[model samples]
Target: MAVRAEQRVDYLALDGEKSWVDFEVKVLWLVGVRGRFGSVHGMIKVDHFRSAATVEAQIDANVVSMRSKSHEEWVKSPEFFDAEHYPQILFVSDPIPLKRLQNGGEIEGTLTLRGISKPVRLNLIKPDCPGESADNCPVEAEGSIRRSDFGMSSRRGTLSDKVELSFSIATKPMNGSSAIP
Candidate 1:
């Protein structure tokens, strides 16, 4: 009898060219401040036999774009992201059920920002075409995190500690095969 091999699927974010990681935080307890990281790269690996998937992503903190140059400068300063010290923000998810990713659910992951790692849950959105194709179709998720948890606890009364995060990306096959193989 022949043994059957386990199948796996992998997707790449295309060097993060078509990916966007945006954030919005409340300022002065009333105004909303927004910004986005310009460089992001990540990969998704799905194990068919195990019905599990994992995601790993990285963001360049040095390439942040905000509403104003002054705001951008403030974010990159030691009081915030501190790009000089920690230039990269990383997130790696625990193995999640493939069905959860397809059907839209929470994905548990650890986000490492400013050299501090914390558990975060992102709400995944179901794609338009499920189990059909991952190319062109964007995979999106959103969640919120407290800045103080990552050691950015400088401004408690001025800037809201909660940061709303939005992530979206279009992926291509990592090995020249379809999403499911």
Candidate 2:
């Protein structure tokens, strides 16, 4: 929908200190390697009149913590995320309905990892609080991606190709602008 000048647009900044992205990949069908990315930054633009929103987020793959030091090194190595060469994982969502972000639904977007961009769909969980108030309730989402899709094809025999990702994001209004009423 065309954005009208008279329509309200609110901007929100993702709270890096409060937001986190967690991932898990099963190994040998029995073990799971779980980790989290500490540095996450993003912005959201909401057009309340259209009841839609879009978001762009960057995750610092280099700032990841795993179950152990060796696991951390392995995940950041050439076999997995390859943080040394590709330091950032990014996601830019197509305009999603505000109701999907507040209630539960699927959100389609583009995910870039190891320099490869592909379409992704994440399942959003209904928030506990009313509206899109990140202070009262974080936006929760989860999805799965194939490692081979991002060129992380090594260890296919022992490591599961599918990687599960979960995100809990908190946001603050940009420049003190409050959410649309």
Runs in model 1 deviating more than 4 A are 1-5, 9-15, 129-132, 176-181
**Candidate 2's residue-wise lDDT over 127-163, tens digit each?**
8875645665788899999999999998889989999
> Model 1 TM-score?
0.88
Deviation in Å, model 1, residue 131 alpha carbon: 11
Identify the candidate with maximal lDDT. 2
Tens-place lDDT per residue, model 1, 1-181, is: 5324455455554458888899999989799999999798878777766888788888999999987999999999999999999999999999989787678889889999999999999999887874666676777899999999999898798999999999886676676543445
* Consecutive 10-residue window with the lowest summed lDDT within model 2: 172-181
lDDT (CA) per prediction: 0.85, 0.89
Q: After superposition, how far is residue 61 of candidate 2 from its true place, in Å?
A: 0.5
Per-candidate clash tally: 0, 0
Worst 10 residues of 1 by lDDT: 1-10
lDDT score for residue 58 of model 2: 95
Model 2 alpha-carbon miss at residue 93, Å: 0.8
Superposed Cα RMSD, model 1: 3.0
